[model samples]
Target: MGRVAVTGGTGTLGRTAVCALRAAGHDVVVMSRRTAPGLATADLLTGAGVEAAFTGADVVLHLATSRGTADRWQTQTVVDAVRETGGTARVVYTSIVGVDKVPSSYYRTKLRCEDLLHASGLRCAVVRVTQFHEFLGDFFASQRFSPVLLTPDVPVQPVHVRDAAAALVRVVSDDAVGRLPDVAGPQVLDGRTAARAYRDARGWHRPVLPVRLPGRAFRAYGAGHLCSPDAAVVDGVTFSGWLREQLGSAALT
Candidate 1:
């Protein structure tokens, strides 16, 4: 098995992918900016240590991402580093579903990164997935302290992080396929429903107020820009199942 290097290995999705790759008998090296015990140190923001992190890697999983427009710069740095290597290894990337159609700043930057990969000259595969279940929790939990939880009334299909990680592992193990099929959760629910499910699972009685925000981003979200029901390859686990797992784990601690 060839060595696989994963950037952003400390993030939730990254960590899951790292474990999946390792379980599949691949030599996995974690690349991140922070100095973690088993991670290769590299900062995509400043373009530092990227070359060393990618050295001798037969498969580079570009899992690193940034907030807002800064993602463009970070992705550019990685593309530059890969170009310098002159190696023909496969570079698998994780991207959000509907990034090309979504009218959000983060999605736009992700689309730009996808473009960079297409033009980077190296073998690459872009695995686009819907929002993770944990991301939905974070979205609703942002205003937990407030009397009412304000959540957008847009549809969301959240996949489990481990399911997405397994799909990525399949991509890395097979031949490089550009722009693979979209991955999404088995169930599709609006933000309010998702938030309520999460709250109920935690035994929190906080009232969820669904607010309709008027904007291109929210409009796109309402129009189902983030959902690809027809083309999506649904995972087995549902959002409720994921919530139960979270609850079970919390009970142990």
Candidate 2:
């Protein structure tokens, strides 16, 4: 098994991927900007210590992402560092399913990073996935103090982070690379339904207000841009199952 280096190993997805890789019997090294234990100290933002982090890595999972347009710069830095080392590593990047369809700034930056990797002259795979269950949970969390939970009126398929990580593990071992198929959870539900399920799972009765804005991003979301029902390479766990696991089976009552 070759050494695998994961950037942003501290992030939710990154951490799950690292565990999956290790479980698959690959030697894994975690690359992070922080000086934490077991992390190969590296920063994609300033391009510091990346070379050392990627040293001897046969496959690099470039899962490190930041807010705004920082990915454009961080991605370029990754390309440079990998190319400088003869470009032997295969990069399995984690991208969102609706990056091309969504006009949001974050999605656009992810698309740009995908472009960079494609032209970087290294073996790479752009694996797009739908929103994670935790991401939706975070959205609900953001509205915790609100009197009413406002959810976008659109369909969502939220995959578990572990499922997403397992799909990535398959991609890492596959010889084929570049623009891989999308991956997502097993169930699709409207935002209202999802929010209600979340509320029920948490044993909380709250007013779920469904809202639709006129923005292109919202419209795109309403059109199911966040769903990958047709193109998923890996069909994963259902949202209800994930909720049950997190909140326990009794919470669903």
Candidate 3:
């Protein structure tokens, strides 16, 4: 079994990855800002708590994200820590698809992180994945009282969190390292469809209003720049299937 460390292990994706790794019989360490049993406390933004977390790790799965501009620093710090640790063989970084094509600050930061990982001289695999199904729910929940879902007129290939976790585990277990093909869900669905699915799943009686975002990011999404026509890896769960599993019969619209 490999000694594996997962940053942001408390997060949805990270926690799933940790569970998968442990199930696969790897010695797993979860690094997060908060303290949990068998978890190493680390704050990537301040770089205050990473050294101990990274020590003696054979594989580092970087799944942490920072708020705003701090993301760049956090990613660099993680890369540097892995390099300093010496025994680290593979650095698996989770990035968003179409980071280069999207003209958003978050995507730009993600691109920068990818660049840092590639230039770190470490054996790295940058796995770009489509948005998660849960991300849409979170987005809708961000606003209160309006009871209306607002979304850009763009297509998205949303993958389940479990599928993403499985893919990450596969990469960590294999010797192949580099920019793997983009990972996406099996089917293509637009934002409105995703919102409607969420609404149905939650039994939410809200109107979903589609808004066209005026930017390169929106255009890229509309043009399918964020999706891979030749996706290297495809997850099994469809968006509707995942929603039904999560919400049961309530997911039917």
For candidate 3, give the lDDT of residue 172: 87
lDDT of each: 0.82, 0.85, 0.81
- lDDT (10s digit) by residue, model 2, range 78-148: 88888877789898888999999999999999999999899877899999988888888888878877878
Point out the worst 10-residue segment of candidate 1 by lDDT.
Answer: 244-253
For lDDT, the strongest prediction is 2
lDDT of 3 by residue, 33-56 (tens): 887678788888777778778887
Please list the residue runs of candidate 3 whose C-alpha ends up more than 4 Å from where it truly belongs after superposition: 142-148, 204-207, 232-235, 250-253
As for candidate 3, its clashing pairs are none
What is the lDDT for 1 in model 3? 80
The alpha-carbon deviation from the true structure for residue 110 of candidate 3, after best TM-score superposition, in angstroms, is 0.6
Residue 156: error of model 3 in Å? 0.8
Cα TM-score per model: 0.92, 0.94, 0.90
* TM-score, cand. 3: 0.90
Q: Which ranking of candidates, highest lDDT first? A: 2, 1, 3
Candidate that would win on TM-score: 2
lDDT per residue as tens, model 1, 1-253: 7789888888999999999999999999899888869888999888889888888888889888879877888878777777777666688988998898888888988998999888877788998899898888777667667778787898988888888898889888888658888888777788788778877777776798898987888888999888867644454577788877877522100
